[model samples]
Target: MIQLDQVTVRFRIPHERIPTFQEYAIRWLQRRGVRYSNFNALNNLSFSVDQGETVGVIGPNGAGKSTLLKVIAQVIRPTQGRVRLRGRVAPLLELGAGFDYEMTGRENVFLNGAVLGFSRRDMARRLDRIVDFSGIGDFIDAPVRTYSSGMVARLGFAVATDVQPEVLIIDEVLAVGDAHFQQKSAARIRKFRQSGSTILVVSHNPASIKALCNRVLWLERGVIRLVGPVEQVMQQYAPDAPSPFSK
Candidate 1:
């Protein structure tokens, strides 16, 4: 359902101090003073997820796990190579990604749904369920800026999982909720998996990855370190330990 071919995402980050716009402009005119270093967030990474596979992405910090997810979700374009997705993708990459802080939670739900390509009628039908699942209760009418981080996570998870997406891309945001809500969210995700959605999740928590994914993709420094069944890959990723899945 998802394919990435030689996907290389590069960023030209400033190597020297050119903090202000005026300094940058002056340096640009000089051409000699300005310097940039190429940082490859993803380097010729290629992977594919079949129609009903649950793939876990595990990596250390700065390993480009989140970048890989953003690429699959089309939040950012690859500097080189191609990505093909055959079905609808629900990306819970960032909680409250499309929300307007000034808008009420009720309004932001519709706004986020619209960003996800849902029609007004569609969001209207799912609105009550989303609110109920979120457990924001009376606070649903309050501006989103007033909501706590956990509250935002609940709302985002509820809305994103409300629809049965053909492909589900989840980042590590699921851990932001309380333990009770985390269990609730995991149960909901299990239901989605049972229905045959292709799922790609990025998590530092090994148990979460092991529990949810059949196959694991281990990335390090923007490259694929290993890809295989969860047990084998996790064994290599974390060696000779009792709690190999521990973060």
Candidate 2:
């Protein structure tokens, strides 16, 4: 099981995250004006994903869905609150965040695995399987930059899932592959569920969640407005269901 307690994540707008923005500071400079120079990506957000269940996070743009995923994945620590995981979490966030651009995909396999808490021996045993699953061919022997975006994504994904994690976190990056590959990935996720792994998915495509998830949570302006069945949350987030942006 995965749990979050009053999590909060804040990002400074003109900070190291996205390079200093002098113009943004200038724009905010106004007479008798008060503003938030920083942004709160997530605020007191809390939820749980029980093992053997699929939880989908849905929301409009800037609604903190992605931030919540990152927090659960431990890709970025929360500024407040805490997340407790039952076991190692395999986070399939970005295509290359877990890889090394200077190293061959083959070399990166072990590196990424270690970063994910696997031992060298374990990765060695899984190397061939990961390579085969990636379907990247000889390019695995060359630097990752030389590989196509889709290739890197596949390789990274294969490495992340090297061991069946107790918790699995995925974003919409899986949409990069061919239909067959997509199906394969989906099958892999299903297998995880069959084995009793907890799953958390964030996607703009709600149908995937409808097909795979048992539970869903909706976020609006950094707070969870709803959490329940997938079908109901999808209807709540539906475009025609009254835009969350409207007055």
Candidate 3:
């Protein structure tokens, strides 16, 4: 289960004229002509995902969909309000996010597992399955830096979903990789849903959202535009929702 109450995430961005850090610091220290603007990536957002519920987040660019996921994923802390989560979260927020490019794919697997709070033996037991699911073949033993973006995506998804997490947070990284791999990953997500895992997914692919989510949250410019049944919200969000190919 997950809950967010009056959550807000803000970022202070400096003006383009203050290009260098030194210049920005000087102006700040002088307390004269300091130029910066606050951008709220998430504005007083509140929502709850019940146990075994699958929620889809859809929005246009800069709509704060990813920010919502990151907040739930605990990658981004809210500047106001509170978030409570009562489950182990496996977050596939960004491909290769916790990876060490210089490390071998095999090494990164263990590293990621450790980051996910798995013991050495636990990772060892799951290693083979993760590798097989990723379908990275001989590349698994090579440095991650040598991998293509698709390869990284495959590995990241495999490792993140290997464990039976209580909550799964998936960002748009699933949109990467080949079609075959995407289907494989989607199938795995379906399995998770069937097994009653709570899932929060952010995707531009309308069809994927429709297939995986019973409820959809539509966000626009850091605000919640709508939240309800998938079809209802999607219809209001994009009446003639573009086809998957357009995504």
For residues 57-80, what per-residue lDDT tens digits would candidate 3 score against the true structure? 998899998888888888889999
- Candidate lDDT (C-alpha), each: 0.90, 0.81, 0.87
lDDT of 1 at 90: 94
- TM-scores for all candidates? 0.91, 0.82, 0.89
For candidate 3, the 10 contiguous residues with the lowest summed lDDT are 15-24
Candidate 1 Cα lDDT to native: 0.90
- Model 2, total clashes: 0
Shift of residue 37 alpha carbon in model 3, Å: 2.4
Best candidate, TM-score-wise?
A: 1
Candidate 2: worst-modelled 10 consecutive residues by lDDT: 27-36
Candidate 1 lDDT, 1-247, residue by residue in tens: 8999999999889887755888877877888566789999999999999999999999899999999999999989999999999889999887777899899999999998898888999999999999998989999999999999899989988888898899999887657589889889988889889899999999877777888999999999999999999999988887654565578
TM-score of 2: 0.82
